[model samples]
Target chain A: MADFEIRDLRASVEGKEILKGVTLAINKGEVHAVMGPNGSGKSTLSHTLMGHPGYTVDGGEVIFKGQNVLTLEPDERARLGMFLALQYPVVVPGISMTNFLRTALNAKRGYDGKDKTKQVSPKEFRSLLKGELEVLHMDDSFLPRYINDGFSGGEKKRAEILQMAILKPEIAILDETDSGLDIDSIKFVADAVNRMRGPELGVLIITHYTRVLQFIKPDFVHVLVDGKFVLSGGPEVADRLEKTGYSEWAEADEPAVLKPEEVA
Target chain B: MATVPKVDVGTDYKEKYGFFVPEDYVFKAKRGLNPDIVNEISWMKKEPEWMTKMRLRSLEIFRKKPMPTWGADLSVIDFENIFYYLKASNKQSTSWEDLPPDIKKTYDRLGVPEAERKFLAGVSAQYESEVVYHSLQKELTAKGVIFTDTDSALRDHPDLFKEYFGTVIPPADNKFSALNTAVWSGGSFIYVPKGVRVEIPLQAYFRINAENMGQFERTLIICDEGSFVHYIEGCTAPIYTTDSLHSAVVEIIVKKDARCRYTTIQNWSTNVFNLVTKRAMAYADATMEWVDGNLGSQITMKYPSVYLMEPGAKGDVLSVAFAGKGQHQDAGGKMIHVAPNTTSTITSKSISKAGGRTSYRVHIKMYPDAKNSKSFVKCDALLLDDESRSDTYPYNDVDAENVTLGHEATVSKVSDEQLFYLMSRGITRSEAETMIVNGFIEPFTKELPLEYAVELNRLIQLEMEGSVG
Candidate 1:
């Protein structure tokens, strides 16, 4: 399929099934909102889609553009236009944000078969870093600081946006990017995401609340309950569920999300 | 006692024709340590009374003090069977062009002259017990910087050498220091004038060309007020069958607002006992950093230390040790903060493979008067397989209650998941292993110069090839 599609995808962690076979597809330029309550496999779906080592894909396929994402490494998937703004971004010490960004950017460039030249000089790198930081309203010194070290909630979310801006991935999966933000911070994050939205970009925003949708309104809404997509509808579904709650979806016994080939 | 090889190689040396020195290349002391040998060594290099007296006093201490029991066992060192001094050539050359063909070939293979021409502002090449080639930049000498060998420093500037010689670390400091004090040979003597900073680093290259030989190098560095300088030293020995002893003592003094960085990358062959004592004193607002790398050698017991003696002083030690089969690298750092507001940081990383052993033993102390002081020690060990061993024994004696001290340590083998990830990306298993190993030592490698870091990475990759399947 040319669209970003997850066909009956199921996954597990530590021998316990967490993501029951859930399926959804989004065309280019479509902004999809994955809304669900706690223990509803929302975060697990994002991680499984990115092929996180902790989450094993037991079945089904995560076909992005055309390739099976389940067959790619997380970094490889990242290079091929898939991104996960982790709910809890892992902190890798001694590796600066600027350094990590440069490496990731180069990896993507290699995947895209772009200019295979010497590294950008320090001056150019710093200039680009300054430009990106100014866009995010971040201080210049933040680039040299270890990735996500001592970052406030809002700063970390903004950092995630900055990464997305610099990387320019084809598909951006934001996991609870506005979970811990105040109204002003959430609006700022939503505005940043909206700025990144374009005809060629497919945004998959995963969240339990519809607060962020108030700014960057989604075109499609998918209800992921018990690890399977029990229901799918338009953006109004987010507003309807925000008021009615997930009680109706919780009553149904959905089939496992994983395909047989994914399970060992 | 094992005999020194007739046709020698340092340490693990073997004898094909019994013990005998090459006639063409002159100067060989009697195969023993005594007053006669000490006097012969000093007199052979030419006269300097203070140094001769210092050597005799060190010899006495070496005789009186028993072998050390705390660190890597040094009972294997046979004092009587070892030659305290061995010279490959007759005279010292201030330029590489003046060196003999045979000696020049050795330095050429080691890339000393090329390194000197490219990066270093000065060079000292010690072949056996004597300095064969020593030179300093004319501009560095014009600024009243004194850069020469230890014996020359004693001859040229006796008072300056005597003032700080035994003050920081005395011969009685340890058994090896005492031995080095007794028969100490060629090492660097560096002095930076007040307010002067040497942009390019000065380097010393030591080579041991004889077997059953003990190369005791004594170094002294003095940085005057507001001055800054960095010094680097490296050592290598040919592979042989008999054990050689390398005991070096390095003393550094950083005055008010001065900074000094001392780096050492040692890769001796398997048959060597490397026991070195390196210490530095940082005065008010001064900084001292030690970047040490240890690879190869039979058993190495080196703990470079820094003493922050005045307020606002800082000390840092970044060290990495690699131990392969038949190697025991016992290396770490010691930080003693005696003044208020002083700070120190110690980071030690080590790798062990093929049944090798690595021990990171560090001692940090904050004296009672050292209020508001802070010290952090981070030690990490990487074992390639189950057979290899790593140990972290950190002793913290913090008497100052107001001081902030943090100590963390971790030991882990390579992860299979990470390997699989790399392998699935079209990287071979060996390349994946190398990448993981490089990443593990990334913290240390990032601190080195570009070329040295690349060389070290390649060396580690080579060492890891047969270590794992």
Candidate 2:
């Protein structure tokens, strides 16, 4: 069964529609990539799927684990095994990474009780975090420091990936994960994301570049233009996007005033 | 990575530290202050004649002093309605078993005895108006460390108490100071011999139990030459319909080459007006540090100050304040440079939520003879909602040359981006807010002991829960 399915999902921001009927589904053990041009409602889709309060779902439903998740809060959807790697990780000045990660993990486990036995053990958590740190080529010394405080752009991306790895969600979405990264940092982040792949996990990567696909290959690629997907194909579509760019679909969703018969 | 216990804050403040034991006092004075009441307080304690004279003089000072039109509003503090004195017991004991059953139940409920036995070097507990239980580690006592309540220090170590008492903070320093001097009952008093280093911290816990009661505790600590000691104070009060007044005076003297650290974690009920005066003097090459956390009270006006008295002296103040609904927290620190080659730093952080208001008010002064002295100040404030408010009132007077002074401040509201980011990680809204707040004050909390840090985090969690919804 598919872990996530969106049926004609329509969303808006500030009374203006940004996502016009987006439809996609990701089943278990499948990697899907959504490539879109600028202003194509790419981030709107990611945030709306995660139930961001700023975005309003005007119509349609998002079915996850046999439940319509559009009515739930962001945290509720998150605990239901859906995760999103924010493109711009928030800078929390005084909280350490260990505290945030442990809290998130335990929260997913539904361990809100006072009984420590039900929660993740400190030893188990430390080992899990240490392994993820090794995968990301980061030292354990970063654990005690504040999360994303005074971190470089590349470091922020890597931290977001580390959060995804620690949560171990059933379905995870990466929003513009490779927007701005140097050569070495991109390699480290791609390698970490690739290592997190499993036969049971559903992966979705949204990006504007195909360079990241060279490391973490996608099973299916869909092109989104003007709030609607225009093309769907295999991994070769990313290569085609790199070569042809997105000018062909600048107005693909709706024909211009000059071209009346082109719509038919 | 230890799991944080669940906090029962889905309710109001009445559930935590707000339960009151029935009023049981050996001697409950009249419901007003006068010369006769002051004399009766002195006579009830059997204090020396000189102390009685000082109390009367302080009473006159209290009456003569005018209320300054500054800081948090104090017109709500009706001095005529406050019970000036309530003697819980005349028999102060060194053992908890020897205490009255009700007072013992109060301490037991607070977990004071268990905490003192396991972690602290010494402990003094004040119930209504006097310290009822006292204990010090034998090893520390053997090292010539004098650890006792302020009243006993006056009777047992009269010469030492007379020498340092009111020396750092004079009676006329402020109206609160004058009131504390006149009716001060229970506070910690410590005297460390020269060169003796007491590694563990000494603590005192005070509580106000009666309605409209006024608690004035006087604390004095003398770190002899080259000696080192850390003193901590914690306070709480029961929820009362009428306002309670808690005015305290703490004085410290760090002698030549000595070091002293004084930490206060004040968590009174919201019906109390906590006006305090705290000051310390550091001699040549000595150091003084104040770590204060104010998380309670309807109106709190306190500014812990340090004076770099001689050359090579150093001073540091790190404080945090949290003002919840219907609360106003006016808190900061003061540093005065009097000698050359002295250095001081002040860090203040405040958070206001749910129509609460917090302000950082500080005074920094440097004299002409304080040449080549350095001072740095930083104050940061956070507002959780549009209804909350924050302000900064910094007073700097500098005259010395060849000195470096730096100040930086930032006011912020919890951003939607930060909250969404944490919520997307499966943390609830209130939990995320508490986490962010805990992080904002991490610098101050990291300086505390492990157990204290955990307790503080829980307290912050309780406060943040009320802010949301």
Model 2 C-alpha lDDT per residue in residues A53-129, reported as the tens digit of each score: 89999999999988999999889999999999988888999898888999999998888846677699989998998
Q: What is candidate 2's lDDT per residue for B252-298, written digit by digit as tens? A: 99999999999888876677789999999999999999999998778
Q: Note each model's CA RMSD in angstroms.
A: 8.8, 10.5
What candidate 2 gets wrong by more than 4 Å, as runs, is A115-117, A250-264, B1-25, B89-135, B205-214, B235-243, B467-469
Question: Candidate 2, A11: how far from true, in Å?
Answer: 2.7
Query: Each model's TM-score?
Result: 0.74, 0.87
The lDDT of each candidate is 0.75, 0.81
Residue-level lDDT tens digits of model 1 in B1-469:
1211122333332254233334353665468787877876776666557667877888888889988777677788888988777663321213445433433343334444454421121122223323432234566788888877777787788889888887888989988899888888768889999999988777664322221123787889999999999887773322222327889899999999999999888876567899999999999999999999998788999999999999999999999998888789999999999999999999999999889999998999889989999999999998988899999889999898799999999998877655544332233456556666777777887877776786676666666765311
On the 0 to 100 scale, the lDDT of residue B447 in model 2 is 88
